[model samples]
Target: MASTVLIFSASLIALFLFSLTGVNANAGSNVFSMQSYGARGDGLHDDTKALRDAWAAACSSAKPAVLLIPKGKKYLNRHTILSGPCKSNIVLMSNLMASPKRSDWSKETIRHWILISGVTSLTITGGGTIDGNGKIWWQNSCKTNSNLPCTEAPMALTLHACKNLKVEDLKVVNSQQIQISVEDCTDVKMSPVSITAPETSPNTDDIHITRSRDVQVMDCTIKTGDDCMSIQDRTENLHVNNMVCGPRHGISIGSLGDHNSEAHVSNVTVDNGRLYGTTNGARIKTWQGGKGSAKNIVFQNMKSAVEVSDVLFKNIRGTSASEEAIMLHCSSSVPCHGITLEYVKLTVKGGSNDVRSTCQNAEWKKSGSVSPQPCSFKN
Candidate 1:
């Protein structure tokens, strides 16, 4: 019988070639387009050549690409460098604005409107608005640098050495210095990001994660003047959760120094945070002839209202610290070890102490009502 009609026509031609290879892999995975390549949502000038020609057609392909600035208000005069070896995934939706420039202040150079370098697996989510107009970089860094160094410019989303980064639901505004600087990055995940400036904005630190590691900053809302989160150099496996810092300088770790640069901030954890009118709530700073060492840090279930020092650990010598909460002056060749504060609940209306250590195997114990001056255990 013609071999049963040639085995039913070869099983209907192999089921129509497996349904055309699943619709050609969903049509190359639905690569969304804003006029095929070149986007613009006119709101009033400077679209930076249609957003650098839609990020060069979304890094010219390797899959994921959705540069849809669809909602309105798009303006930017200078600085938008996203140099990368990106593998795809860049989505910036909702009222996008990267505006700045009045000749960008005589071009002295420090402009990083949206610079992301050496990326790998990048993702910048929606609810957008990145306006670092910064009053012309804070009136040109207070007229000619005023003896330069630390807080004279540069920063608005500068992520260098990135790898597997993810920044969610953005709303960063008026940044001059340190709005979001994730340097030496690795597997970073910043969630629900909402940072705002101008509480006397100068060196506006909202999120400065340096020498990074497997970091995770969650449920964020940072209002700043400085140090909403400043974990500087040589960091490791850090985690911060349910955060909401204010008027600035609340969560910090180290001003650590002196060549060797050791900062094994092991399994650090800051949870259920909410620090308002902050000037210090949780800190572990090191300086005063510098050397290095900060290990196994933890601050849990935090809540500080009207702070001026719910907790501050400092060490001075230039960088504006004459007196202000927990100042530790370590010298005798570098010493500060194993800092731990558990179940902390602080409230300081007028500055002073909650906990201050001079570092020699420091350990601060807490369960509540800590009134400072007690931690000097070095046996």
Candidate 2:
């Protein structure tokens, strides 16, 4: 598994470097500034319409386009969707903030704030901040403070049905819900990104990848209230490397096959992860009575089980917030198989060195110096 990941990482890094170089070439091409379209950049006015117009002009361009949101400006926006099957490659250098007022949102736009959909060969960079202004949303969320009705909140940024996408060198903070969502996309690469939110903030997952393929999330720093990165159903060929996750739930595989539905995910790899004081180290969670296969997953340092099989966790070293540092709760009806844990060492945070492992209805193999012991199936 290590050898395979090394090779794949090498090639994927090369490919992304090449594509990102091409994407940066647009810096010399046409520029469509948001301020030119009547935006104030004051951090108070609604800049949604101006941004929409800028996106329209950029998308319609015959040559590569650059939608520039110049530095040091904090333009406030409402639910904004930049949708396209544009004529050429598009670059969105984003530096913006979202309105904090919950009433400004409606049922139609509550799920997404800055949505970039149906665009191909898109690149988003520009070392700026995307503030979700989530103080109001967090106050209203049922998860944090009870007595409020549970309602859907907006994800700070979403990329839907996009191909050949590259998002890097950005700071995403205080998202109302999930920080960054990659859905139904292909050939996506995100690297050297920072995602942050209060540890008490509700459901602010750093990154969520679902129904996507060939996606790579590398060299990211994440501190959030939810899973640092959640890999959901129908995602394949996904790679996560050199991630720093803490003060949150660790990397998760699935809450898949929910409500007795069938789902399949395969070819996932997570490598060189550093998780500190997290609720779980490597997790794979599948609902009871759910059907589907989650297979060929190699976590060089992670867990989840939707009929999970052929999964490996290697070289994982971290401090677990709970006593059960390693937990594998596979479904009884569809037990997990071919699971392996290698060189895993996890200790409880600020407590005795008596951490434990729990394995149920799963078949596993262990190799090398595992602390708190390793799981072995009962014959």
Scored by CA lDDT, what does every candidate get? 0.61, 0.81
lDDT for residue 51 in candidate 2, whole number 0-100: 89
Task: State the lDDT at 27 in candidate 1.
Answer: 42
The residue-by-residue lDDT of candidate 2 on 1-379, one tens digit each, is 0111111111000001112333465345788888899988888899889989999999999899888877667889999999999999988875789997888999988999899999999988867789998879999999977888999999999999999999878789999999999999999999889988898999998899999999999999998888898889999999999987776577788877888888788999988876655766566778778888889988784222234678888999889998888888876545778888788889999856989888777788777777776466432
Question: What TM-score does structure 2 among the candidates reach?
Answer: 0.74
Poorest stretch of ten by lDDT in candidate 2? 8-17
The local distance difference test score of model 2 is 0.81
Q: Model 2, residue 219: what's the lDDT? A: 94
**Candidate 1's residue-wise lDDT over 238-303, tens digit each?**
899998777656677766663544544556788877776665567777654555567677787766
TM-score of each: 0.29, 0.74
Clashes by residue pair, model 2: 282-302, 282-303, 283-303, 283-304, 284-303, 284-304, 284-305, 285-304
